[model samples]
Target: MSVTDPEPTVPTRDQVRQAPKVLLHDHLDGGLRPATIIELADEVHHELPAGDAESLGRWFAEAADSGSLVRYLETFDHTVAVMQTGPALTRVARECVEDLVADGVVYAEVRYAPEQHVTQGLTLDEVVAAVQEGFEQATEAAGGRIVVRQLLTAMRHQARSMEIAELSVAWRDRGVAGFDIAGAEAGYPPTRHLDAFEYLQRESSHFTIHAGEAFGLPSIWQAIQWCGADRLGHGVRIVDDITVADDGTVTLGRLAAYVRDMRIPLEMCPASNVQTGAATSIAEHPIGLLTDLRFRVTVNTDNRLMSQTSMTAEMHSLAEAFGYTLTDLRWFTINAMKSAFLPFDERLAIIDEVIKPGYAALAG
Candidate 1:
């Protein structure tokens, strides 16, 4: 009699790397190469906490792991400081695409605040143009093997949401795919940028909000019910609205039920969440529960430099922690591709042509 093969539960690091991935929440500035950061910092005369690339990389990871909110936020100062020039932005953006391609990402949307990069005399339009140039150049270099887009981000604590939202629309036909608002979420809510959200919705634009992360369910509610976000950045706190009893029965609250029912994509960043104390660890991250409950869950690397993570690392760690098979990883890839702000035809093409066949080969 023919015997059945053992279940394929977890994948190896190399197998994870070979799988074509889709990224929806990576930050352009947050994933700069350590050596590139050093060179750019020296050219701009910016003082970094560490002089060497190896030491500087350690400094970023350590600062994020320090458990201090100030230190964690301060880590971006160095990355943002060096990324203030047009060429600097181009180089960083190009390198970001290259890194993602090497990590087996077939599609990605890298985000950055255009206003933040204007300190070095580059206009908002110039910043966007420079980044798009990098993406184009890198995609050309990759020979149509990858597709990358930009998501213009507005700082939540700032008053430029409307401006950033406009920029997103202005560049929509260009390389910009969507808009997002990110920053501290406590007193500053998504409703503060209601005009921006409403404007995007009116223009038939797509956007996501950084919600339910450092804050709680109310932030998520504001982003969804109030601002009508297409997706949730982090959204880890939505788990707070869910309960499990001693008998292993589970119940979802109104907001949680609404989120799952609506199939709102949660751009869950496990490593970055742990670094910011939103998650205790990879194993304890809410992605597992969300995935099990059939929520629209997609894994992402919010800040690769701070977390020292890549798509391969994130997938491999999840597999190690949750015993996720290649089939599970394919679910995440397809989820991200479907949630992408790219045109629906392009999204479908990648899922059917790239993700499905790649996973089938890996599983075989």
Candidate 2:
């Protein structure tokens, strides 16, 4: 009797990490190395919740998992405090790119607010320059293996949005990919930054707004309709527009229908959603429904340090929860690439060359 050996099977983590990925909603300050944070904090005399790198990393994870938005926002204070000067910003940005490269990310757009990093006597322009320099340094160090872009972000509650928007426009050719507005969504809505959005639109620039995570459909509606967002950040709350009948019929509300028809991308961060109380668990997350319905959905790690997640971990969790295969993971990667702020030709080239071939080899 001839017996066939079982097919090779390894942890999904290995497969997911080997796949080329595209990330569009990551935060620079949110992805720093724990040891680097401690060192930087030490240089600046900034107080930290934990003394050692291991304890500090665990502290961030636990604090973020507390299910309190207030506590979640509090974590950034520590990270942002350490990233004040040019060298500190350069180190963080360089390490951020190196980390993404190690995670097998072929392309990433990291967003940060220059206004937040200007408290240490550096001009907003200097902060942008420092971060760009770091990105350049990382690119050389990677031997040009990865492509990194910046999304100059403006805090929604702050008054420097127009300035940030203009800065993004000015740096369009110099590593800045687009503009973004991020902050607490409860009291400060996207509408508060209408002028900034209008300016970006007029300049033929791209911008994504944080919406539909902590808030509801109204926030998403304003981001898409009023603000003309190119994409939705953490748009998990858009699930409210979807209804399932007892008879197993799925119906899309008008807003949902519009979003699906328009092919708008949803930057869904499953781990971050769970940490922020957006969803009770990954199994119950709306990503499964949205993916089923063929929405333009992209998986992202919104805050790596806070969520204690990477692309590999996020894909592993989703695969375990939803029974995803290499094909499903490839679909999410392609969706993100197609929705990237890069030009159509560049996005298409990566999808056709890197992403497609990389997945094909793994799928085999």
Question: Which candidate's TM-score is highest?
Answer: 1
Query: Candidate 2 residues 321-357, lDDT tens each?
Result: 8877777788899999999999999999899989999
13: Cα error in model 1, Å? 0.5
TM-score of each: 0.98, 0.96
Displacement of residue 216 (Cα, Å) in model 2 is 0.1
- Over the stretch 1-364, how does candidate 1's per-residue lDDT look in tens digits? 0023244668899999999999999999889999999999999899999989999999999998999999998999999999988889889999999999999999999999998999879999999999999999999999988999999999999999999999999999998999999999999999999999999999999999999998999999999999999999999999999998999899999999999999999999999998889999999998988888889999999999999999999999999998888888888899899999999999999999999999889877
lDDT of 2 at 188: 92
Candidate 2 accuracy as lDDT: 0.91
**Model 1, which residues run further than 4 Å from truth?**
1-7
Looking at candidate 1, what is the lDDT of residue 164? 95
Alpha carbon lDDT of each predicted model: 0.93, 0.91
TM-score of 2: 0.96
- Which 10 successive residues of model 1 have the least lDDT summed? 1-10
